[model samples]
Structure formats: C-alpha cells, structure tokens
Target: MSQHIALLGSTGSIGTQVLDVVRHWPGRFTIAALGAGKNLERLAQQTGEFHPRCIAIQQESDLPALRELLNVHAPAFSGEILVGKAGLNAIAESSVSALVIVGLVGLAGLEPTLKALYAGKRVLTANKETFVTGGHLVQPYLDRVIPIDSEHAAIHQCLKNEPVKAVKHILLTASGGPFRTFSAADMQKVTLSQALKHPNWVMGHKITIDSATMMNKGLEVIEAHWLFGVSYDQIQVVVHPESMIHSGVEFVDGSILLQMGAPDMRGPIQYAMTYPERLPNPEPKVHLDFLSLSRLNLEPPDLERFPCIRLAYEAGRLGSGATAVLNGADEMAVQLFLEEQIDYCAIPKLLEAALNAHRQESTPSAPSLSDIHALDDWARRFVREQANPLTARSTG
Candidate 1:
C-alpha cells in the first residue's frame, strides 16, 4: 500500500535524503505535502517534482518569491502555499498526509510535531531538538514516531517487539568527531571550517559542529531518555571512531544486540518510511569487512575534554525547560561561531551559562507547548544578554 508523506524541511540534508528514498521507491510513498525555511528556490524545485497538495515556508516574506518561482517553473502546480508558524501548524493538522517527516532544525519543529501526532499522523522525524525540548509534552500523543537518527533508529530496530524490561540499557555511539585526537588546547584554536568537517557522516553545518562538541550526542541522550522512556543512567555514549556499529542495546542477560552499517542516513530514513517491512538499500552500499578492519574501539566519553555531554546530562537531570535552554543557547553560539563572532571552545561555555540561568528560572516540571516555546525565547535572550564581547558569545 502506498503512503502519503509530509516532507517537512524538504530542502535539508535529511529531507533531500528522504526525497532520494521517495525517488527510488516511488511506488511505496507519495509526497502529500512539503515544508521548508528560507530556501524557496529548492522548495520550488521540489514542488515541481512532487506536486504536493500544500507546502509551507518559514517566513511570510518568502511566500511571494516562492509563488513567483513556482509560477514560472511549476505553473500547473495547484497546491496552497502557506507561511510562518500558523501555516506550519496548519500543514501538520491538514490530515491529508498520514506521515509527517520532520527535518526542520531546532524547536521550530515542536508545534508542528504535536499537531501531526494529535492529528493521528505517524510522525517520522530527524529533528532531535523537537524531542529534546518537547519530549515530556509530546510523549502522550506519540504512538508511532520513527527515529531517523542512525543511533536511535538502530536501537529501535534492535528492540523490535522485545519487552522493554528485558533491555538493560542503550549504548548510543558517536563518530568522536574530526578532532577526536585533538587536545583541549588544540580545540580552542580550531576554526569553523575544521570543526564543520565531520569525519564520518555528511551533515548540516550545525549538526557537524554539534558532533564536534559532542553536544549532538548530548542532545541525543536527552532524546533517548524520552524516546525509549529510559532513565539517564540507562543511556551511554561510546566513541566509535570508525562509524560502524551505529548503536547497541544491552539486555538484562548481558547479551548485546548491535546494528552495524555504513554511515548512511538513507538507511535509517528508508527504514522509518517502509517501517516493519524492510526495504532494499537504495544508497551506495558501503562494503565493511570486519575481519580486515581489526577491532572496534569503544571508550567512555571524556567529559573533561568535551563538557557539552556533561552539560546535557546535567540539564536532563534538572528536568523542566532546561534542555530547551541548552538547545536555544547552543543554536545561538553555533551561529555566532559559524559567523566568526565566537571561538570554537566557547560553545559549551555559553550553553552551560544559559542552562544554569534557565534552571534558576524554570519550574522543575514538564512545560506546556506555549511554556516551552516561551522558555526557548527567554533562553535565546539570556544567551544574548550574557554575551562577552572580548570572548566568544551568543548572537553575532
């Protein structure tokens, strides 16, 4: 049976990979709707090909330009073009699509995700921030969320109808980033270009940097807690420099189930789309010879070397809107660093400060949709106010 898919963030790395899946297995899935931010040109191209019933863009000002582009190239396309937050929410609640594939960055995906879940759509998401900040609130409505992140997806596959209690813990693996062997002093002198080069998977600039800081793993920890209903202590991050062994789940009997594959996003993306029924791999099948590669090294994450991971654990333990603050501040800090306004090492410093401030101000409980989003705003503002000009700071 063919399924309708709402391809949110259709122009992004994850979104494009999803399109690749759709393109390869066009009979299995059809594009019902699409959403993107500030990339109208690419959106227009996608619209021309997929011809979704409706589409969404981030800014209201982007609407006219998108319309003009669509008119010139995709003249026969009859879908409604919507704009801004309300538009995104509207698309999510449209019910025209049974599956909403969220690839948008940050907390921008929160409201739309809830809307889709409430609308009874199976949401497949690569948006980790949505889970990180809104997990406490979104859990009740989520029945079938496909984790598109390779590690989480691996864990999900490993679980496969198994009893949750039978599982001992989840081992989330990391690529150890580009500067895996670099000293703290060396990291401080790192440039944006160097930090963005992920040694394993090809990803967006923000996520690549997050991996470098191990903050991506940090955020993933929070996501895992919510996704699997596991405690912080049950989730562990290990450095897997080779990028094989996406993740593993250890059972109570000490038997560990591992999901090994080449570092390919499409593998997980297609896994989520086709669901319980496995789809044949569409990406370039990377050959991995375990015998020749020698041993796979697993080591505990160095919290002293990478403080963001510790900060993530701390914020998660603090509960409430603390994770929201960490994400908000990190976004600001990452943007600043990308723009050459801040040093690489300052990312976690700024995030830690913001987390501390949010902990002081927020209640020790899960926040509502509006409350979390409001806290997201407040956190961004706090990071901006705390910016130190001489050193790296939030908001370029």
Candidate 2:
C-alpha cells in the first residue's frame, strides 16, 4: 500500500530530498500535503508538479500570488491554504496522510510536530530543537518517532530488534566540523563564512554553524536520550573525522553494531519514509573500493574545545527546563554569531550562562506546550541580556 505524506518545510534540504524519493518511487508514495517558508517560487513549482491535495506557505502575503499561479496552471489545486497555526493544524490532522515529515529548522517545527503526534500520525523528524525544546510535550503522543538526521538514523537502525536493557551505550559520531584542531584562542577569530564551510556535510546555515561549535552534536545527544529512553551517561559522542561510520551501539554482550554509509541524507530519509519496508531508488550508492575504506578511527570529543556538547549532556541529565533552555539559548547565540554580533567562540559561553541561570525544577514533570513556549522566551531573553550588558542593566 502506498503511504500518503504531509511534508512540512517542503523547500528545505531534507524536504527537497524527500521529493526526490517521491519522484523515484511514484507508485509507492503520495504527497498529500506540503508546506514551506517564504520560498514562494519553489513552493509554486512544487505545487505545480506534485499536485498535492493541500499546500501551505509561511508568509500570508504570498498566498494570493501562490493561489493565482496555481489557478492558472493547476486549477484543480483549489485546496491550497495560507500557512499559520490553523494551516499547520489542518495538515497534521489530514485524514489521508499516515506520516508527517517535519524538516523545519528550530523551534518553528515544534508546535506542528506535537499537532501531528496528537492527531495520530507517525512523525519522521529532522528538527532536533523540537525534541530538544519540547519532547516532553510530544513523546507520550508518539506511536513512532523516527529520526531523519543521519547520525540518529544510524543509531536507530543499529539498535533495532535489540532490547533497551541489553544496550550498553549509544556512540554518536561527529566529523568535528571545520575546526577540529583549532585552539580556543583560534576560534575567537573565526568568521561566519569559515564556520559555514562544513567539511563533511552540506546542510542549512544555522546547523552548519552549530556543527562548528559542536552544538549540533549537543542537540543530538539530548534527542537520543528522549528517542531511545537512555540516560545521558549511556549516550557517548565520539569525534570520528572520517564521517564513514554514522553511529554505533554496543550491547551488554560486548558486541558492537555499526551502521556505515556514505554521507547522504537520502539513505535515512528513504528509510524513515518507507519504514518496515525498503524501497529501491537510483540514488548514489556507497562505493567502499573507490574511497579506500581503511580502518575506522574514533576518540573522545574534547570538552574543553567543544564545550557545547558537554553543556548538552549536563542539560539532558538535569531534565526539566534545561534542554529547552539549551536549545533556545543556542538558537539565539547562533543567530548572533551569524550576524557578527559575537565571535564563534562566544557561542558556548553564552549558552553556558543561560543554562546556569536556569533553576532546575524539583520533581520535574513533562512540560506542557505553554511551558515550552515560556522557557524558549525566557532563554532567549537571558542570552540577549548577557550578550549586551547595557540591556541587562536596563532590565535589572
């Protein structure tokens, strides 16, 4: 049976790749609904080609132009909708869609994710901040929460069919970004362009910078804890510069299971979209011979150099508003760094201050959706205050 899909963030890196998967296996899947940010032209083209039952755009003003464009060509597409809280709700609750692919960046993806889960749709997620910021709100509603990020996908595949108690530890691998060897003093001079130049993967700008500071790995650590029901200590981050071994899981029997593949998002994307069954696609295959598959190297991530990863583990262990604070603070810090308001090295420093200021809740309970929003607002305000002492004093 063909699986119908509602794809949020339809113009993003993961969304576009999802389209590729749909194109290759036309008979196996259907694009029932689609949504995107302000990329109207791409949205228009996607609507024109795929002819989804419904479409949503982030900017309300773009709706008229989009509707007109669809009217002229795909007039049967009378189902297009203006993307907002209601639009997200409609797409998540659509009866035809069995699963929702949420590739949206940052906290913007959080609400829709919860909506989908509550509506009883399986969620194939790439938005780390959703789990980082509000998994407590979404986890109980989930029947299946699949990972779309390669590392998490690798860990997911590795741990399949194994009892949670039998697992020793989950080893999440990172490529060490573009500055693996740079000293703390050297990071102070790094530019936005330098941080965006990721060595192993081509990803969105915010995530590229996060990788440089190891904040992406930090977010993933929290995500793994939520997704796998593992303790913070049970999850490990290893600096695997080769980028070949996606992730590994060591069991209680001392046997290690590893998932290795070329650094391609499509592999995992396809896996999640067609779970319990693998579909054949013409995407590039991993050729071990041409790349010279030598021995895999792994080492402990340096907490002194990549303190963001350390901060994430601390937040995950604390388990309250901590992950929410870490995510919100890092989001603000990344924006500030990109805008040249702060140096790359200062990103972790700002995140640490925000996390430290937060008082861990005693007898922590799962946060409500409102609580997640409040924590995000508080964390952003705290980070901005630290970034500008004048603002801090005025508020004080």
Candidate 3:
C-alpha cells in the first residue's frame, strides 16, 4: 500500500524537493495534506498537482487570495482549507496519513510538530528549531521523529540499529560556508550578497546566511545532541568543503561509517520519506568519476571568526532556555543581516548581545514549550533594539 503523507511548508526549499520525491515515486507514496506560508501561487500550483485532501496557510488573512488562486489553478480541489495554527494542527493530526514532514522554518515549526507527535504520527523533519527550542517535548517520541537534514540523517544511517553506547562519537560535517577561508578583516567588509553565495549548496536565504556564519552547523549540533542522545562535546564539527562525505560515526572499535552522496537535499529527503528502503533516483545521480577527482578536506572551526558557534556551545551547555534564546537571536540576526540593516560581521555581535540579555532575565524558569516561544520573541526584539550598537562595532 502507498504511504499517505502530510507535508508542512510545502512551498519552501525542502518542501518543494520532497514534492519532487513524491512525484518520482507515485507508486509508493501519495500526498494526503499540504501546508505553506504565504506563497499562494506555489501552493495553488502544488494543490493543482497533488490535490491534497486538505491545505493550511500560515497567513490567515491571505485565505481569500488563496481561494481565488485555487479557483483558477485548482478549481477541482474541494478539500478543506484551514488557517493558521488551527489549520496546521488539523493537517498535523489528520488521520488519513501516518507520516508527516515538518519543514516549516524557525519557531513556526514547533507547535505543529508537537501536535503531530501527540497524534502518534511518524514525523520526518528539517525544522532544527523545533528540536532546538522544544526538544524535551519531542524527546518522548524520539523513535518517531526522524531527521531529514543530511548531517543528522547520515548519523542516523551510521548508527544502523546499534546501541548508543556502541558509538564513540559522531562527526557532523559542515561545508564551512562561503567564508571558511575568510579572516576577521575580510568578514568586516562582507555584504549580504557574498554571504548568500554559498560555496556548494543552494538553500533558502535564512539558511544560506546561517551557513555563511556557521550558525546553521551550530544549530545542527544542538539538534544532533537531541536526536542522537550525545553530549555537545561528543558531537564534533569538521569543516568538509566537498560535502561528499555527508557525515560519519566513529565507533569505540575504531571503525568509522560514513554516508556519502551528492550534495543534494533530495537524497536525505527521500531517505527519511522511505525509511528501510532506497529509491532509484530519476536524475542527477552521483557520478563516481566526478567524486573520485575531488579531494576532501577537514579542519577545525575558528571561534574567533564565527562567534555564533561559540554561543551555540555555551547555550547548549547552559541546558535550559539558553539554546532557545540562541536560536531566536540567530534567526532575527540573519534577517537583519539579509536586509542590510546590519553588516555581515554584526550577525555574531547581535547574537552575543541577545544571549547576554537573555541570561540576565529576571528569572530563568523551568523549560516549557511556551516559555521557549516567549524567549524566542524576546530574543528577536532584544536583537533588533540592539542592532545599531552592534553594527557600529562591526564597522568600527
């Protein structure tokens, strides 16, 4: 029987690629539901193609606009159209599908993921922030929430049903962004365009910028900690420019297992979508000749250059609301940098200030999903208000 899937963030980078995977294997899977942000044009197009049983939009006010678009593009899609969190939960908890993919970016992904877990659905997700902020809530269902990110997926494959104690440590590989070779002086004058130009992978703007600053790897480190039950110290980050050896695990026996593939998100997406099975890729297959010619390299990340990474380790070690604040701050900082409201270097400084302020909060309460959201909001505001001074520091 074909598996039914509920897809969140169906219009974004990973979402679109996931749709491609479904399109590739029409015999193995069917789209039961879909969710998107405000991209009604793309949503309408997807609805026209997949005709999901139900659809949800992030912006409720855009419902009329979406309805109009669907009338033209998907005149036949009479499935339910829900709005906001209510709609998100409706599809997340929908009984028609047992598999849910949560790709919604940032804090927006947390609630719906929790809803799906509550509904006992097997979730495969790219939303690192969901685990970054509310990992404890999702911890109870660790077996059900599989990772779709390449690094985590690679680690998942390497473990291969082995006990956690059997592992020595996991190495989370990074492309080191476009700024890997750049010095502090070079970063000081960096612009939005340079940061967005990732050396290898093409991704959404926020992630591309996060990659430039290595904050994406840091967030992945936190996610790996939750996903693999490893300490921050046990999970290592090695800068691999080739991105061929996606990631690896070194067991206590000294034998390392590495999952290698093309630098394509679709590979990992398909892996999570079809667990315990491999798909015959239609196009863009990895060429052994091309890979054989490329030389792989690894190096330690420079803390002096990428302070966001340092903040991530500190936040993760702090063990409560700190990681949540760190994620929220980076999300807002990346937006500010993208808009040119702050220099590329100020991204780290802005994150530092937000983390500092969050530490001084009148009371650091116990971990709660709601508190994580509140901390996320507070961190965004804190960073925005402090942007001017940090930008001054960057240009000074």
Candidate 4:
C-alpha cells in the first residue's frame, strides 16, 4: 500500500525534488495535500500531476489566481482550497495523511510542524529553522519527526541502531560556500550573485545565502543538537567542499561511520519518506562516482570570517530564547543582504546584536510556543533597526 503524505511548500527546491522522488517510485507514495507560497503556477502543475485531496496557499490574495490556474491546468482537482496560516495549520492537523513533509521556509514551518506532531502525524522535515527556533516543543515528539536535511539525515543513517554510549561525536559537513577561499577583505565586497553561486548544491535563495555565510551549517548544528540527543560540543563542523560525505559519526573505539552520496537532496528526502526500509531509487540515481573523483578535503571553519557558526554555538549553549533569537535575526539579516540593504559582512553583526539584546531582556528559560514566536518577532525587529544605520552609511 502506498503511504499517504501531505507536503507543505510543494513548489520549493526541496518540494520539487520530493515530487521527483514520488515520480520515481510511482506506487510508493501518495500526495494527500499540497501547500506553497507565491508559486501558484508550479503549485498548480504539481496539483495537476499529483491531484492532492486538498491545496493551500500562503496568501488570500493568491486564491483567485490559483483557482484560475487550477481551472486551466488541473481542472479535475475537486479538492478543498485553504488559505493563509489557518489553512496550513488545518492541513497539518487534518487526517488527510499519516505523514507530513514540511518544506515550508523559516518560522512559518514551526506552528504547522507542531500541529502535525500534536495531531499524531509523523513529520519528515527539511526546515532547519523549525528545530533551531522551536526544538524544545518538537523534542518530546522526536519519535515522530524525521529530519530530511542532508546533514541530519546523513547522521540519522549513520547512527541507526548504534548505541548512544558507543558514540564519541558526530561531524556535520559544510561545503564552505562560494567564499570558502576568500580572504577577509574579499568577503566584505561579495555581491548577491556571488553568494548564491554555491559550489556543490543548487538550492533556494534563502538557504543558498545561508550556505554562503555558513549560517546554514550553524543552523544545522542547532538542529542536530535537538534531532540527536547530543551536546553542542559533541557536534563538530568540518568544511568539506566536496559535499560528497554528507556527515559522519565517530565511535569511542576509533571507528567512524559516514554516509556518502552525490550532492542531491532527493536521496535524503526519499530516505525520510521511506525510512527503516531501503527501496530501489529511480533512474539516474544518486551515488558517489569514486572512480572519477580524486581527494576529499576537510578543514576547520574560520571563525573570524564566518562568525555565524560561533554565534550559533553560543546561542545553543545559552538555552533560553537565545536560539530562537539567533534564527530570527539571521533570517532578517539574510533578507536585508539579499535585497542589497546590508553588506554581506553585516549578517553576523546583526545576529550578534539581536542575541545580545535578547540576553538582556527578561525572558523565560523554558519558553512556550508563544514565547518563541514573540522572541522571533523581536529579533526580526532588532535586526531591521540595527541594519538601518548600516544601510544609511552604505547609501551615504
């Protein structure tokens, strides 16, 4: 029997790859529901192909256009159409599927993910921010949430059935982005195009930027802390430009286990979708071409250049609303940098200021969902305010 699943962010980089997986194993998966943000054309194409029982859009304003597109493209789709956050939450809570794939970006993914877990649905998620911002809420439901990110998924594969005590530490690999070889002076002048040109993998703009700053790896470190029951110190980041060895685990006995494959998100997405069971992949599979490859390099990350990683470690250790603030600040900072409002170098500065401000404020040590959301909002505002002066100086 095919497993039924609901996919949020159905038109994204992860979502499209997931669809590719579904196409590969036609009878293995079913799309019960689909959700996306501002990409009605692609969403409609997916709906036409998959014919999910329900569909969701990010804004109410996109509803009419979506319906028209559905009419032209997926005229046979008689399913329900839901709008905004409420619609997303409804899909997460509904019984349309037993598994929910969260491809939604940023903080928008947190509530729906929480809702799905609470409603007893297993969640296969690629959204690192969900864990970075609200890992506390999701931690109790760890049994049901499977990570779909390549790094965490690689660790998940490596650590399967291995005793926690046998482990020494887990290593999360980083591609080191486009600026890995760049000097400190070179980093200050990097343009948006340069930052988005990732060396190994092709991803969405937001994540691509995060990768350039090494903040994606930083966020993954926080997620790994929550996904696997490990301390911040137990997780190490090695700059692996090849991206072939997704991640690894070292045992106390000096043995190491690593998961290696082509730099493809589909491999992890498929693993998460059909876990505990390995199935035959579609044509043009993802695997290492060691015969054609040469050497893999590993180096320590430069903290002086990419301070986001250092900031993430500090926030994860602080343990309160700090991680939430860290994620929120980075999201806004990345956006400002993408929009040319701030220099690439200013991303870390904005994040540090937000974390500092959050520490000084009186906040709950054990924050509720509301508290996390509030802190996220506060951090965004803090980053914007901090970036304004920089924007002014740049314009001047």
Q: Model 1, 1-396: lDDT tens per residue?
A: 789888888999999999999999877788999989898989898989988999889898777788899997678898788888888888888878878999988888888998998888889999999988899877886566889999999999998878778889999998889988999789879988899889888888889989999999999999999988888999989999988999989999999999998788999998988888896888756556667777888888889989999999998888857888788888888887887877888888889888877766736568888788787787777666666553424233
**RMSD of model 1, in Å?**
2.1
- Give the residue spans of candidate 3 off by over 4 A: 288-291, 362-366, 388-396
Cα-based lDDT for every prediction: 0.86, 0.85, 0.87, 0.91
Question: Which residue pairs collide in model 3, if any?
Answer: none
Worst 10 residues of 2 by lDDT: 281-290
Model 1 misses residue 111 by how many Å?
A: 0.8
Separately for all candidates shown, the number of backbone clashes (residues 3 or more apart, or on different chains) is: 0, 0, 0, 0
Candidate 3 residue-wise lDDT, 1-396, digit = tens: 999999999999999999999998877889999999889999999999997999999887898899999999999999999999888988999997999998899988989899899999999999998888888778899989889999999999999898888888899999999989887898888888888899988888888999999999989988988898888888888889988888999998999999888788888998888888877654556443553654778888888898888888888887658888888888988888888888888888888888887777753534787788788888887787788656645644
What CA root-mean-square deviation does each model show from the true structure? 2.1, 2.4, 3.1, 2.3
TM-score (all chains, Cα) for each model: 0.96, 0.93, 0.95, 0.97
Among all windows of ten consecutive residues in candidate 1, which has the lowest summed lDDT?
A: 387-396
What ranking emerges by TM-score with the best candidate at the front?
A: 4, 1, 3, 2
Error of 2 at 165 (Å): 0.6
The lDDT ranking, best first, is 4, 3, 1, 2
lDDT, candidate 4, equals 0.91
Model 2 per-residue lDDT tens digits across residues 1-396: 778899999999889998999998878888899988887778778888888888888777777887777766676776757577678767877786978999899988998888888787899999989889887776676457899999889988998877789989999999999999898788778888999999988888889999999999999998888888788889989999988889989899999998887787888999888887876644856444536775777888999999999899888887757888889999989988888888888899999998888864342446777787788888888888889778657765
